[model samples]
Target: MKNFAYTRAGSLSAAAEAASAEGADIIAGGTTMVDLMKIGVRNPDALVDISGLSELEGHEIGADRIRLGALARMSTVADDPDVIAAFPALSESLWKAASPQLRNAATLGGNILQRTRCPYFRDTAYSQCNKRNPGSGCAALDGGETTLHAIFGGSEACVAMYPGDLAATLVAFDATVATRGPGGTRTIPFAELHVLPGDTPEIETVLEPGEIVTAIELPVVPAMRASHYLKARDRESYAFAAASAAVGLEMDGDTVRDVRIGLGGVAAVPWRATAAEDSLRGSPLTEATAREAGRIAFADAQPLEGSAYKIALGADVVAGALLQAKSRMGGE
Candidate 1:
């Protein structure tokens, strides 16, 4: 928000070097960064804009994975024929995310890296938010209702949830995030990118300062063709989820051989509901089992004051999402 020097790098390495230095930040799509700046939540001394780097541009949807360019716009990825056909969950999450203009300007990597939608953090009116100032304490915990706060991996300190929808799709598909820096290239599991707030909400990810995301790779799954992302929000459209489910089920005849389950709106990160997934992995695909799996996903969720509905809503979400996915199979 304050006056900051800007540099547009020609290469990823150049961008990394500029960003890795002191008080420098990376700006790819600039959607999230600009918003944070406007709210006084982000004030960098200098910004290294990496949107110009050719090394971080373009993509290929493969049989094993969809190799995503860091700079690929959300609209482009959502509208790609292969993405629409092969990854219905991924495509749907993108399309359901924001307005058309926002999707056009927001890059895929930036969307995944976007921050929480927590009101206290966004407003900057509250001076006691620990995420904004360490040791300042969290006002959301005692002052506001925590229905939208986290139920997993939350410390007494903070409960801000990861507010991205696309990340849930990536988690369901077992995706990998690719990054590059002076140390060369390394790929991290998408699940590992986000960390629970625990005691440090300011430190959101593992990316060292100055590192630039190169790509995100999602594993291929035939189940994805039978997958769906169901978001239960306050409204039909243009609203963040109240509770959501991403489900992909593989059937061996009438029985399910494998299932991938990921949840949103109830946790600090894109939650891979392995317990729910385990419930459905080798069982018969029935509405009962799907609902039970949904129940298992939230078994460990400890709602604060008002979010206890997330437990029931989360169960219905998984059930609804799985049932919707099953109906999509050809000749179902």
Candidate 2:
């Protein structure tokens, strides 16, 4: 890693002020940031450490909403009884993520802000990685390894896949991210936090430079209790997802009252499957209906040569997640 000056911000305002400087990056848990820096994918001139800011720690599970502080450890949130009971999918997403050591250290803000796991983007040896270097061609697209590339939200400039678990559940539950920056504080829908890999693949989130994510707010809903997040990977543990689904279902007798779906590992951003949710609104929550919804979820997929299997695998994951959610509905 490159030599960089570091400062531990004593307050939110101080953090924002320090991070606003040119080439300064924010560091909380340092899980992803350190790795990227070591690989030469990210080389900040300075790091503004905000991990000591107590204002950005802990969580609150209220009757109407759940607020997870940006610095709240992933394990803390995943192991909370209230979070598990109220937002199982959210809890599971964190649980199924990295190992116990990582969960203990990874913070909510850093987890959402984690970059892609694309080999081309990580290895500086590859000259073509639009995400790493704008205007550079994408090596993953030019007969490179594409099994992990995005099938949705990919443009001619980039096809990198998002590799987070919690963000997908947040998107499924319509969570909001609160941020404080040089311009002041604001809240945006979590779905809008991540931008598509369009012409500017290098730019990812909508967060402004020096903006610090303060917290994530999720509305408490009945359907969320019946939610599930299913991740299909090459192995049983510690492997990144090949295809994953986050699903929440509300059932009324044999009919579906409401549903929310989010897909990961197959898109440039945490993907909300609105079309699939719309298709299953009045339908029964059965294997057949779930399968149909899954099919609808991937209808617009534009898979690459090695990633074509993700369509089928992603559909199966969606179907499995929906069924698992249904099973949690107290035999409804």
Superposed Cα deviation of residue 273, candidate 2 (Å): 0.6
TM-score of 1: 0.97
Clash pairs for candidate 2: none
User: Which 10 successive residues of model 2 have the least lDDT summed?
Assistant: 323-332
**Model 1: per-residue lDDT, tens digit, 1-332?**
69999998887888888888888988988889999998899899999888877766777877677798999999998898988888788888988888888999999889998888888888787887888788788877876867788877777888887778888888878899999876777899999988888778778888987777889987787889888999988888778888888888788888887788888888888889998888887677778887888888999998887777889998999999998888888414
Give the CA lDDT, 0 to 100, for residue 153 in model 2. Answer: 96
- lDDT by residue for model 2 over 1-332, one digit each (tens)? 88999999999999999999999999999999999998999999999999999999999999999999999999999999988988899999999989999999999999999999999999999999999999889998888999998999999999999999998899999999999999999999999999998899999999888899999999988889899999999987877889999899888888899999999889999999999999999888889989999999999999999999999999999999999999998643
Candidate 1's C-alpha runs over 4 A off are none
Q: Residue 29 of model 1: what lDDT?
A: 81
**lDDT for each candidate structure:** 0.85, 0.93
Clashes of each: 0, 0
For each candidate in turn, the TM-score is 0.97, 0.99
Candidate 2, residue 130: Cα displacement in angstroms equals 0.9
